[model samples]
Each structure stands twice: as structure tokens, then as C-alpha cells.
Target: MVRTAISRVILGVSIFAWVLLLINPGHIMSMEHCHVSDSGPSVSSLHMLLEMNPIASQLTGWGLMVVAMMFPKLIIPIQHIYARSLRRTRFSASLLFAFGYMAVWMAVGLLMIGVIMGLHLLMPGSYLPVTGLAVIAIIWQFSPVKQRCLNRGHNHLILATFGWAVYRDALLFGVIHGIWCVGAGWALMLLPMLLPSGHTFAMLVVTFIMLSEHLEHPKVPRWHVDFRAKLFRMIVAQIQIRLKEAQE
Candidate 1:
């Protein structure tokens, strides 16, 4: 029941994020709109250190992107967290775990924003950055390091049952899982950011790719490609089930 509720909540949030992105398209976060002031060096430093509005808005959109594209990947981890916690504290433990996970992604989002901004400054309207990122993503997709990260992401640690330890364990588990997730998906995530138009469509495609990849079981790290078409198989199975039900 708890797992069901959590899944529903995560699904709803993911849907909400998608809706927001669709309604406004890239207005919430667009690398094109990210301003690079050609002004005083000292003031640029000040803005870099103190500017909150742009930074805050970027983070907000990045958070939504994370929810939309990444939350589905967390269902298994969330289930594991729920199953391992004490009955009374299961909800709290799961919440902490999610918070910790989001925290890591949020921090990485900041760094990603910086990189995107730098690229924008260097090449304002060119597709060079996007193309370059796509090439890098393809290379990363076949790299042993990415496979190692994917394998590590499947790991679930033992949880504590009492006091602060419970919360600590849950949070740390989330942090560790999130780090692996970042390692596996960062290149793909950046691809969508560099797109000039059709940002939502690009995001959807990237999300599908990432989610499909996550559906795979852990495997030994290797420099090989795996499309992990598990989602397609599941859809086919569901279609067959419905067809049989209709016939009966």
C-alpha cells in the first residue's frame, strides 16, 4: 500500500512536470535565454556570486526536468527503501532518501548549468555545442565507466532500524544511488539542454532512452552497447493481455 501510494505520487509529479514543460516549452529553462553579460569583470564576479533570480529559476527548471526524466528510474530504489524501513517510519525514510537523491542531482544541475552557460558564451547560435554533446553522449553510452555506474546504481544497501541511524542510512543510500545515476546519465542530460528548439521533444526522447536503459539488469562493465528494450517488451506484453481480455 505504501509503495503504491509512493508510486502514485511520483507518477503525478512526473506528469505535472511534463505538463509544465509542454505548456511553456523551453521557457522554464533554455540555454538560449541564459544571459552572458559582456560587462565589467568585477560586476560579473559579483553577479556570479550573488545573482539569485536566474540561478534560482535555472535550478527550478532543472528540478522539474529531473523529476520528469529520472523519477521513474527511482521506483525500484524507492520500493527497496520502503521495504527495508520500519513500518512506522517507512514514509519518513523514503522521503529522506528521495531528498538526498534530489540534493545530489540539484548540485550537479548547478554545475551543468555553468557548463551550458559557458558554451553559450562561446558559441551563441551555433549547433556545434549540441552536435559535440551528442557525439560525447554516444561515446559515453558505450564506455565501460557508464556500464559500471549503471551496475552500481542497482545496488541496495542494508538500512538501519532505529533513531538517527535510520534517517542517515536512507539519506546516504539515496546519495550514493544518485551519484551513480549522474555518472550514467549526465552526458545525455546535457544533450537536451543544448538544443535550440523542440526542447520538450528532445527531453522526451532522452527520457525514454534513459528510462529504457535503467530497465536493464546490472551487468559486468564493458565497452559495448545495450539498447535495453525492456520497455518495448512490457508494452507488447500489455497489448497481448488486453487483446486476450477483449476476446474473452
Candidate 2:
């Protein structure tokens, strides 16, 4: 009981740190870029958008990362476990993973910022992602393979408080995450690359939305999950049969 209490305290501190870094990334950047000016949009305009943002982007991203890192290699099943409750382990994992994942994305963001900044300097104009991000979002969400993977994970998770009916748990989750992530993100990263240049704010906004959606509940219905499960089972059965045939 005492050990559990200590773990919870540590986890709370870690989550607090993750939330702090996420909410104040600009402030940290400002310390380094102290000489920056009012060259961009006014504070009022930004404030209006900020007001409309219901989900705190940084917090959500950090929270999801915490969950991701908590289980390490396993993704959705743990996430499935994490999302539906106030489980303390999930909280701890979310907090720790946030810092680690932020370290990774911060580095990636820096590289992207430099590249885009260079383009802004050279071109002095132009931007992207504002117009086309939604289209790419729709396609990835509806893609056949991604839908298949999500269905499999969802079906398995619905009753999985302890273990899945399957033998290999980690492998199963990894496969689900690979497909889900492809559906959920990768293309969102391409938004920056796709945009004309100097649309850093736009890219960031889109990325934040993408990150939030990945962590949130699926847009579809619970009843919508059945078709995909059957398909996955059939595919697995077919593979098993082929393997047996080769042996014979």
C-alpha cells in the first residue's frame, strides 16, 4: 500500500511536468528567441482561437505519450485500458511517456522549423496545410487496412480487463498500433511538407488536432466494429491454413 502511494505521487509529479512543458512550449522557445518581434499574427487573434480549443492540445498529446510509453512496445490494448478509467498505472505511464515522446517530437519539430524558416526567408511568402489537411485526414481514417486493424483491436479490448483470448499479446497490440498510427498520423506529419512554406502556425494547429483525434474516441459507432473482426479472423485463418499446407 505504501509503495503504491509512492508510485502515485511520483506519477502525479511526472504528469504535472508533462502538462507544464506542453502548455508552455512557446515560453521555453521564447527564452531562446528573446529578440523575436511582432512579425506574426496579433495576440488577440491567437487568443480567440485558443478560446475555441476545447481540448488542450499539448496536454492531450503528453497524456497519450504517457500511456504509449507506459506499456512500451504495446500500444492500443494498454491504451484501451488507459483511456476508459482512472487507473493509476495508466496515469503514471501517461506522465512518463509524455516527457520522452515530447523529447522526440521536440527534436523533430526543431528540424522542421529550421527547414520551413529557411524557406520563409528565401520565398518571403506562401503557406500550405490550411486547405488540404482535412482531405488527407478523411482518406486515412476510411482506408481499408487501417479500419481492419482498428476493428481487431477494438473487439479484443471490449472484454479484455486481464488478457486477450490470443496467445501473443504484445505482438497483437503492435500490429494494431502500426495500422492505427498509419491511419491516425503519418500523413499529418506530411502536412508541413505539403504546405507551401511559412505556415508554421497552421501546421502546428493541424498537428495538434491530429494528435487529439488519435487519443480521443473513434468517430464511428460500437455496432460498426463487427464487420472488421470477422474479416481479421478470416484473414488469420487463411494464413494458418497456408502454413499448415506448406508443412504437409
Candidate 3:
């Protein structure tokens, strides 16, 4: 049943992601380039847009990016929510959890925009910042700190299943999970924003890395090389199963 739920959710997420990619893919992929420039709209007019729309629009895009890249990682937690909730409340509970999770990431997006603005002031249009961030991401991937964060992300809460407590537990679970996920992927997540071009591709690569890492079992935190290729293995296994079933 959990497998079926995961498959259905994956299908929905894939369709949503493809729709976002089909629409203004660039804006959806790039959250760092939110400022006005000389080649672009006028300062007064841009400032008006910025005041009225930019932040909100960027947050919308950021939310879509998270939906595309991070939702897959939530499958287990979401399944747990569904399993623990009363039949009638499961969907509502999951929605509340997603809202809580998205809330954290939206806050992070605002901070990330500020960081990018600072970088722009220091080195506008330069790849140096992106390259530096990529290096940092690589370092983080192998660090014990990253492992510890990933391990913490695997920790599930003992949910309360009655009254407001059920909703509260679901929301709190999402918030705590989002915090750990941010710790695990913030550096990598920043890469797509820092890139001047190929934002979609960068996002895809980061998503793959994150999904791979999430497949790993929590282990002793230590600096070690871990490619976390279980996702690839799982795909292969699934394909093999399908082929055997076809032959049967």
C-alpha cells in the first residue's frame, strides 16, 4: 500500500514538475537573479515591480522548485503520516505537513536571495561565487556534519493521532524534517541560483544528488566518500522485475 501511494505521488509530482519546466523554466530555475540591471527595466518601474511582485513571484518559483526536487525525499515521511492518520484525515494531514514543509523552504529562499544579493555586490555576473559554492557543496557532501544532518532527517516523530494534536504533529514533523533537509542540501540548492545559465540542468543535477543521498541508510557520522547510488540500483531492480514479469 505504501509502495502504491509512493508511485501515485511520484506520478503527480513528475507531471507538476514537467508542467513547470514547460512553462517559464528559466525563472522557475533561477532565484538568484531577481534584481534590476541597466540592460533591464528602469529602476523606478523595477522597484515598483520589486515592491509589488518580485518577492512573491520568486517565492512561488522557489516553491515549485522544491516541489520538483524535494518532494521525492518526503515520500517516507508522508507515507508515515498517511499510515498514522485516520482514514478521513490522511489527505488533510498530509496537506498541512506539506504546507509546514514549504513554509520553511520559502523562508530559506528569502535568505538565499539576500545571500545572492550580497554576492552580486561583491562580484556581479562572475562565476566565482557559483564555483566557490560548488566546492563547498562537494566538501559538505563528504563531511560528517552532512552525514549527521542526513541521519537526523531520518528520525520520525511519535505522532499524536487525536484532535488538534494530529494536525499539530504533522506540521511539526514537516518543520523539523525541513530543517534537517536544509542542513543537508542548502549548499547544493544554492548552486542553481548562483548559475548565470543552465539553471534547469543545475537544478536537475542537484536534485539527483539529493535524492541519491536520501536513499542511504543513516550510519556513523564520519568523513567518507559516499556516492549513495541506491537510487540507480533500485531503478535497475525495478526494470529487471518488469522484464521478468513480461516474460512470465
| Best-performing candidate as measured by lDDT | 1
RMSD (Å) of each candidate, 1 decimal: 3.3, 15.7, 3.5
lDDT of 3 at 149: 92
Q: Ten consecutive residues with minimal summed lDDT in candidate 3? A: 31-40
| Number of clashing pairs per prediction, in order | 0, 3, 0
From the highest TM-score down, the ranking of the candidates is 1, 3, 2
Task: Using TM-score as the measure, name the better of candidate 1 and candidate 2.
Answer: 1
Supply the global lDDT for candidate 2.
0.42
* True-vs-predicted CA distance for residue 20, candidate 1, Å: 2.2
Query: Model 3: per-residue lDDT, tens digit, 87-185?
Result: 877888888888888889989999987676556544657799999998998899899999999999999886787799988988998899999999999
lDDT of 2 by residue, 131-240 (tens): 45547655664565544434443443332233332223323434444444434454455454435543345444544454434444343432232222333455689999
Local error of candidate 3 at 233, Å?
2.5
Q: Any runs in candidate 3 off by more than 4 Å, and if so which?
A: 25-28, 31-53, 240-248
RMSD of 1: 3.3
| Tens-digit per-residue lDDT, 78-161, candidate 1 | 888788878888888888888989999999999998877666555655689999889999999988899999889989888898
Badly placed stretches (over 4 Å) of model 2 are: 1-18, 25-76, 79-125, 152-179, 188-248
